[model samples]
Target: MEVAKILHMVGGVGETSYALNSTLQKKAMHIAKPIVQQSISQLYCKLQPTESLTIADLGCSCGPTTFITISEIMDEIYEVCHRLSCQVPELTFFLNDLPGNDFNSIFKYLPTYDKMVKKEKGSKYAPYYVVGVPGSFYGRLLPEESIHFVHSSYSLHWLSQVPRGLEDDSGAPVNRGNIYIDDTSPPAVIKSYVAQFKQDFSTFLSLRSKEIVSGGQMVITSLGRSDVDPLGGEVNCLYGLLAKALNSLVSEGVVDKEKVDAFDLPLYAPAIEEVKELVQNEGSFEFYQAKVFELNWDPFDDQMDDFVADSFVSGENAMKTIRAVMEPMLANHFGGAVMDALFSRYAMNVAEHLKKEKTKYVNFTVALTKRG
Candidate 1:
């Protein structure tokens, strides 16, 4: 699959769109806000007094949190300038995502966002400019040495493509009966995924190193695994459940089994060590902070839980969140006819699994500085 073409959050402001279904992502951004603020502040201290500052938010999908994140970063910079008695710099903001992302949804809110910044910052607000640049972050997307700070959240785990060599010499699927790397996947499948991550991440760092000025800072938060072993994390369980749902449909002849075998999600939740190794090997940035954190599987589950009743509701909510992000790619690959049924089965499987045990998503946040 061509990930650049197919990977995008569900568009529009309707019920199934990412705008409505992204509470989990919003929560993740809130959790990482403090780190983001600190990174900006520190980078500000290192920056020479200038009339303008350029910042980029990579993988900024359309949602309330997209503007929220930009606002928060601007606030941090304003605070730093206040303390130093420096004139607030003119702000140039680049909001980037895959080309297929819903830029219109994000653009619609810019007027309100600008007014909010002006209201909060008063006369001290910098002359702010925002532009949408659509492309993959795994390659160069900006002019050289232009960005002073970079921030990305709840992205970066998505690989550029499904890892190569998931087929045998005769071209049969090697990862049969599984849609992702699982405990049962062969060592070859595991190695292929890891190798892909290393290459993609290294390229990401290299391109950013060229685009960011020396001493600039980058903060990233993405779905990751706490376990050193790639196969032993909550992400594996999540995809495993998805695979089960697909298998059930295959059994009932509602979906083609061979189609399932040919499909693999273009995602990999890297271990912290693997991330650290890539940063070190790439030799362009200093890793200032790297930590793993946990979030509940169902971030929206606030009500009282009757194991039987709430499980279904919680499962449905979880499925919606996944659907908002994954549905586009799935529908393109698996055909739209089966999606409603596929997710229905997925919801039940998740509901049943949650009844037995609580599940959490492991997340990793890292802060880096471009080397001189």
Candidate 2:
């Protein structure tokens, strides 16, 4: 249930959610659809004529984009089936998210799909059925050896929770900021996160190995940073801006600064090397293809045609929309008491950033594979 709840928190109609809904979804889809198609082609190439292909949309937040991803997969399947003279395999789609996700919203979109399937009855397009599995992907959410393809977008980096000991003062001394970055991270924070990723990925591979059958394929893509950042480091820029706003509230006596800093923002951005290490250790999946792609995806980036589209209109309205979008996250991240103050800080910063820093280079990563 916490997983589901967190999905809603991340996907619900708020600043973070709105950004996902408005900008991030569009950017992710542009890259994800094509890569998924490529992965499907690769999978089909290694498949036997008698084997049926299956697909899954993992970490699918609540939105039509999920359907779009599924649609692309189906289209790819359709094309491959036609070319290879292979019959459309019975398609079983597992739409997975946390227990607190907006399943109802996601489910509502399924009937239209079912209706389309009915209209095409007796056709060879393949029968596709979608069912919601509410649980965490860090563990096995599907029956072993039952899936043909697995895909998750912009979702893998978030750990179940912040790494431990980053905030604790029980030992030598205490500090603020992310624990994994602290100079005194108990010597285990990084290892712990990496270990968890290894374990989670191992379970993913082991379960997928069973579900995928031999020769099946899986494609996963999400945000990843460079192994080495010559600059300060890889920071979740949006999250950092958010943190700054929250901290500003605390400094202004509008919220508790200590609590704001203490609250861990659940996220992780591993490098390509880390990804390689995880996959190499698992050994269940063969290294098919891997690459770090620079995606021009962030809406807030300078490439936007309308950074301040409403210059002619009152600045008050623009600020209002921004506040509407960010308030919920501030409230959820900090608390209602200081939510307004936090948003105010964010608004001031955004106004200043619009006038100063504005540029256009947001990057992402893509990884493709086949069942080894």
Candidate 3:
């Protein structure tokens, strides 16, 4: 599958839209707000640009979370400038995502977003401007040495394409029953994923290195695992359950087993250290700090209890969240007809698993600066 052509969150502002089901991403961003604020403050103080500052939010999906990020960034800049007694610069924002992203839906809300920014900035700086740049962030998207600060939240885990080398010499799929890295995945399957991440991330950093001006900062928050072992994380169990849901349909002869065997998620959540080492290896950015945190799979379940208080409700919410992010890809591979039933089965499986153990998604955030 051509990931750039097909990968996008469910669009529109409907019940199943990513706009409504993106609380998990919003929560992750909120949890990493300190890092974001610090990065923005550092960039502002470091350059102290008086005329203009350009920012880019990579993988800016069509959701409220996207605007919230831009808003928070502008507010932080305003606060930092006021506190430091410096001139607040005119801000230019480049909102980037894959071509398939719902740029129209995002544009629809810009009028409101612009009004809010205008009121807050008052007469100090010119109005904040947003440019929707549709393209894969894995490559160059901005002019050379143009950006001041970059922010990407809850993205970058997705590989540019499905990992290569998933098949044996005889050409049989290596990971037959699983969709992502799991306990059952062989050594070759695991190696293939790591190789893919290394290549993609290095390319991303190299391209951005040419775009972001010297001393500019970048903050990346994406789905990740804290565990050293790739197979030993909450995300493994989550996708494993989805694979089981597909297998259930196969068992019932509702879908072909070959199709399930052929499908694998084009995503790999790296460990926090893995990201640091990759940046160091790429030789473009200085990795300052990295952190790992976890959130309940049901984003709405904020309590720290070790038990699922309402398995059914939690399962429904989890299903909706995953569906909003993944339905388009699943529909592309498995056909739109199977999506309703497949996710229904997935919900039941998640509910059953939650009854046994409450699982969460591990997240990683990194702060970096482009080397001069």
Candidate 4:
């Protein structure tokens, strides 16, 4: 599948839209806020008397979390400017995502966002301007040395495309019956995934190196694995369950098994060591800090004590979240007719899995500065 053409969150503000089902991503942003603040704080401290700043939020899908991130970064910059007794810099914000993303939804909400920023920061607040840039971050999306600070959250795990060569000499899917790397996947499948990640990450760092000025800071947070055991991570379980759901449909002859075999999700969860190694080899950025944290699969569990008892509620929310993000790609590949049945099965599987274990996603946050 051509990821750029097909990959986008379920659009609009309807029941199945990303805008309504993105609490998990919002919680992720909340957890990574401190790292973002620290990165922005250092950027301002290192470059005082800054007259203007340009910021980009990569893979900023349509949602409130996009503006929430902007507000948080601006808050830190405002504080830093106040301490330095300098006027807050005029700001240019870039909200970037795939071309198929719902830019219209985000644009519709911008007037409200501008009003909130003006009221909170005062009408005299340096003009804050936002523009939507549509493209993949795996390549250059901005002019050379245009950005001072860059931030991406809950993205980057998605590869630019599925790794090439997942088929045998006879042209059959090597990783048959699986949508992602799992325990049953062969070594060749694992090797293909790692190779793709290394190449893609190298390209990403290279592109960012040109777009960011020397000494500019970047903070990225994404799903990751904590150990070398690729199949042992919590994310693998989610995919495994999804595979089971698909296989169940295949068994009933409701969906074609060959189609399932041909499909592979373009996602890879790298370990922190892998990221460090790639950045070091790329040689354009120095790692400032890296951290790993776990978030419960159900982000709303904290607000409710009886999540386990209300398994249906938890299951529905989880299903909606996954559907909002994956439906576009899945529908494009598997046909739109299968989505309702597929997710219904997926929800039941998730609910059953929840009863057995409290799965938590491992998230990695890294801060880097361009080498001078």
| Full-model lDDT for every candidate | 0.89, 0.59, 0.90, 0.89
lDDT of 1 by residue, 134-195 (tens): 99998799999999999999889999999998988999999988989988888999999999
- Provide the clashing-pair count of each candidate structure: 0, 13, 0, 0
Please provide, for model 3 over 212-238, each residue's C-alpha lDDT reduced to its tens digit, 9 standing for 90 to 100: 998889999999887877877678899
> Alpha-carbon error at 244 in model 1, in Å?
1.1
Superposition error at 248 for model 3 (Å): 0.6
lDDT of 2 by residue, 300-365 (tens): 343455355432232232344434333443456566676556656655655554444432223354
Judged by TM-score relative to the true structure, which candidate is superior, 2 or 3?
3
What's the ranking of the predictions by TM-score, best on top? Answer: 3, 4, 1, 2
Each prediction's TM-score versus the true structure = 0.96, 0.79, 0.97, 0.97
Error of 2 at 167 (Å): 3.3
Give the lDDT of residue 352 in candidate 2: 54
Residue 13 of model 2: what lDDT?
47
Model 1 off-target regions past 4 Å? 302-309
- Superposed by TM-score, candidate 3 places the C-alpha of residue 260 at a distance from the truth, in angstroms, of 0.2
The weakest ten consecutive residues by lDDT in model 3 span: 119-128
lDDT of 1 at 295: 74
**Candidate 2 stretches greater than 4 Å from native:** 1-22, 48-51, 115-124, 169-203, 227-234, 296-333, 337-341, 347-364, 368-371
